[model samples]
Target: MLVLMLSLVLSDSLVLADSLALADSLALADSLALADSLTLTDSLALVLCDSLMLWLVEELSLADVLSLSLALTLCDSLTLAELL
Candidate 1:
């Protein structure tokens, strides 16, 4: 009877060890999935930032062109006034 009790205890400990290992594996998988998701999010953010910068550059270029044209018109008017 004592031997049977010892066997039962050993088997219970083994089962406990297996459950702990399974829990650790599940936790590690969850962490890996989170890391992958974060990486994807970062990539998308970078793309959005790049597109916004391009749009801003285009807007600035348009403003620059308008300013240049205005300056040229002022210069022409001044030249005509001096001639008159």
Candidate 2:
């Protein structure tokens, strides 16, 4: 579970990296699916995505490796695109 969470974080951190739109959308979709599928009450993925969403609004920025730690820190409330 931890590995899955970490990988998802790392993967999302890679989005908004100036990549091709198709690739970005696909990646975002995959992350979204994973986040949606998680059944845990804590739903760390959701929390991470929430923080990421918050950061996105603040910075209007997305960079590889950006906002990963921020999401990880809010491990309990994360949902899909937690920051968004």
Candidate 3:
């Protein structure tokens, strides 16, 4: 009968819609998971970079202090020689 055929078509359409929705949900979940992992990786890289920068800054500061001390000693010696 025509009514029976129409009912069958409607049921098939509903099933197809449900399948598409489920597929979309799965795809969204996968995308979110990938984004979270990338964020974590970026955060870890940033932490490592920050530590490296701090270490380099400390080393450079130490070298600067040593150079300044040497310069001050040389200036004092020159002054003393001139006075003598």
Candidate 4:
């Protein structure tokens, strides 16, 4: 009886994981559609990137001086490994 209950719970989790994947796919499609409608110029992109870089740089520790994005990634093991 316990085994039967465990199997049911496990199956439910598989269904949830599959659903999550489907949702992610839909989100990606929506994002692509939005990007397709936007017009970003090269100069504006560079300025935005510079501003973002400055923001990230400002978040670094005094001693280490790593970028803020890198610091945030270091806090999570999966992201750290993926970044490397």
All candidates' TM-scores? 0.45, 0.29, 0.44, 0.46
Candidate closer to the true structure by TM-score (higher is better), 1 or 2: 1
Off by over 4 Å in 4: 41-84
| Residue range with the least summed lDDT across 10 consecutive positions in model 1 | 75-84
Flag regions of model 2 displaced more than 4 Å.
Answer: 1-19, 43-49, 52-84
lDDT of 2 by residue, 2-82 (tens): 999999988886764546776879999997897677766646555655665676566555553355555554554644545
Q: What are the runs in model 3 whose C-alpha is more than 4 Å off? A: 39-84
Task: Tell how far residue 51 is off in model 1, in angstroms.
Answer: 36
lDDT of model 3 at position 47: 51
Candidate 1 per-residue lDDT, tens place, 15-53, comes to: 999999999999999867855866564545445444544
User: Over all chains combined, what TM-score does candidate 1 have?
Assistant: 0.45
Report lDDT (CA) for all predictions.
0.62, 0.63, 0.63, 0.61
Highest lDDT scorer? 2
User: What's the lDDT of the predicted structure labeled candidate 4?
Assistant: 0.61
State model 2's lDDT. Answer: 0.63
C-alpha RMSD of each candidate structure in angstroms: 24.0, 16.0, 23.7, 11.5
RMSD of 1: 24.0
